[model samples]
Target chain A: MTDYIVPVLLFAACAVALRKKENAYDLMLLGAKDGLKLLVSLIPTLILLLTAVTMLRASGAMEMLSRFFAPAFSVLGIPPETAILVLVRPISGSAALALGADLMAQYGVDSLVGQTAAVMLGSTETTFYTISVYFGAAGIKKTRYTLPAALIADITGFVVASLTVRLFL
Target chain B: MVMSWIFTGLLALSLFASLVLGNGSALAAAVPQGARDGVNLVLSIAGSICLWSGVGKLMEVVGFTGFLSKLLSPLLHRLFPSTRQDKDLGQSLSANVCANFLGLGNAATPMGIQAAQRLAKRSEGIASDELCRLIVLNTASIQLLPANVAAVRVSLGCQTPFDILPAVWITSLCSASLGLCAAWLLGKVWRR
Candidate 1:
């Protein structure tokens, strides 16, 4: 039900814009060209981040990190499996989503781990990817303070999602 | 930059760890597979980027973005004081925020890129505070509905896909607010 809002809003916006008798198609084409340009600029950074994350995961570094963090995460009321999910989440949404579904399958959806995964996934953004793509598209060379700030937010999201899941579910 | 260090650090760590853990084959496979995944992700998102960016362009042309800017100006102005003086920047940012609020992350990218581009124009080699703030905000986007997460839950056969709504609301709000605050504070400290 909530999914229709964006598509409907987009359709209405296009209709109204077309009704203005302006060459909306030309503007849209220009925007699409910009999107293509943005995509091209983003590819390198995307590949870099993707490769790095993949290597980290494949090398079992994420597992080690999760194991290392489990005690601390447990102290904070998070399950060990969720520690890795939280860590990987801000880096890649798809990776996090895959982990999230696995967690749900391992634990029932109503379980604390499953609900926490869902909430954590919902709360956090793909921080690194957003930074890379958005900043890359803008051709911003140096990103100062953004990464730390976003990571701090990621931490806050992790903590808050855990607490909220406990409280609500 | 800091990002380069992070990338290198992660890669070096992964390589060293793989050697120690004897996961050489998996590490070796990751490189090409990762590139393929990256390309696939870009391709998958490209169509939505074109469509939504096109629609965002139409909204800008029809003055809908202007209306959105006006509506969002108070909050956006507070968060992005520099944007108050730049109408184009504010409009693009507002449109991006609106799309993000609707959980239209793919649709929001073009406007975010447009806003970033506008902010980058005045910046030299280093990223401006405004650009940094914009990136942080986008990274901690506070969505009213997490449609994608809900959809995934439903596909997993959850009886109530949206049951996590309250948690989502709480978590997103906390992260976004805290992120913006951290960015703002850091910017002040760095400028001084």
Candidate 2:
């Protein structure tokens, strides 16, 4: 069912474009051009955020952070491995993906740890990155309360994913 | 922005810590590698954003966005009250949510940015409460497919990659709801 979404949307879009007598090719190119512009503006922000995040991860800061958070997370039924993914998930999707994949590979995907990682990955977004790029692009200087709100949401996702694994898996 | 400062601090601290902790080589490798990853990240989503944004334009041309806006207006109004008068904002927000629902966040991202820009048009340089809520919604987007995670599972030879759908749904919905509530409450409090 999930696999069919793209194909279904593609067909719908083409059909609608044809029905409306809009030049599908031109419209797509126009959008692609806009996307290019948007992506270009985002590059600087992405580079800075990614550089910091990647450096943090590669420098083993996450390991220290994970160790610090491990005891608290364990109280909530989360393992140390999953704790790293949860912490990184809000900062960078690629990092979270790599950690999630590592978790699945290290512990079978069906295991509780792997399952928790998968659910959390699916449920949350890269909050800080999203705030930066989106707000940065829109030229909004003050982002009051948005960070804390999004982080609250991320924590909920992590807690819920852990509980979901415990109850459902 | 504060985020810039935070990232700068984090990078400097990490580099300093790595140098002191004997992991300088990893940090050294990460600098160039991070730039490459940033480009790769953009490239990875460029095609998806292009395709989705195209589909979005077509949806507008074909009046599908109107239909969608009407269908989702009740809920959209509750979340974004200003959308009641602004069809364009409603349409873009609806498209963003639609893409998110399909687990196409990379696709939804351009739409989310579009919506944020639209919302910002009515305000000064500072973002409005509604715009902040929209950003919060996008960050806590509720995914229906969880396709990427499932794909990773499949690659790892999991028998049922999509088995976590219920978990994803429950967690995402809860978080999104709670996040929205927090945004709304905080927006009201901070405004006064």
Question: Of the candidates shown, which would achieve the greatest DockQ relative to the real structure?
Answer: 2
State fnat for each of the candidate structures.
Answer: 0.75, 0.70
Of candidate 1 chain A, the 10-residue stretch with the lowest lDDT total is A97-106
> What shift in Å separates residue B152 of candidate 2 from its native position after superposition?
0.7
Those runs of model 2 whose alpha carbons end farther than 4 Å from true positions after fitting are: A1-67, B1-70
Q: Per-residue error at A113 for model 2, in Å?
A: 0.4
Assess every candidate by TM-score: 0.68, 0.69
Candidate 1 local lDDT, B1-192, one digit each (tens): 655666787788798889899989999998998777666556655665566566656765677645665687788888878777888888789989877876555568999999999888888657888888888888886876565566556655677777788779888889988998999899887762
Compose the digit string of candidate 2's lDDT tens values, residues B70-159: 676789888888888888887778888876775545557888888899888888668788888888888896876665576567766776
lDDT of 1 by residue, A5-123 (tens): 56687678667877888787788897778767766866676666777767877898867877888899978777776876776687766556555655665577778988888898888
DockQ of prediction 1: 0.45
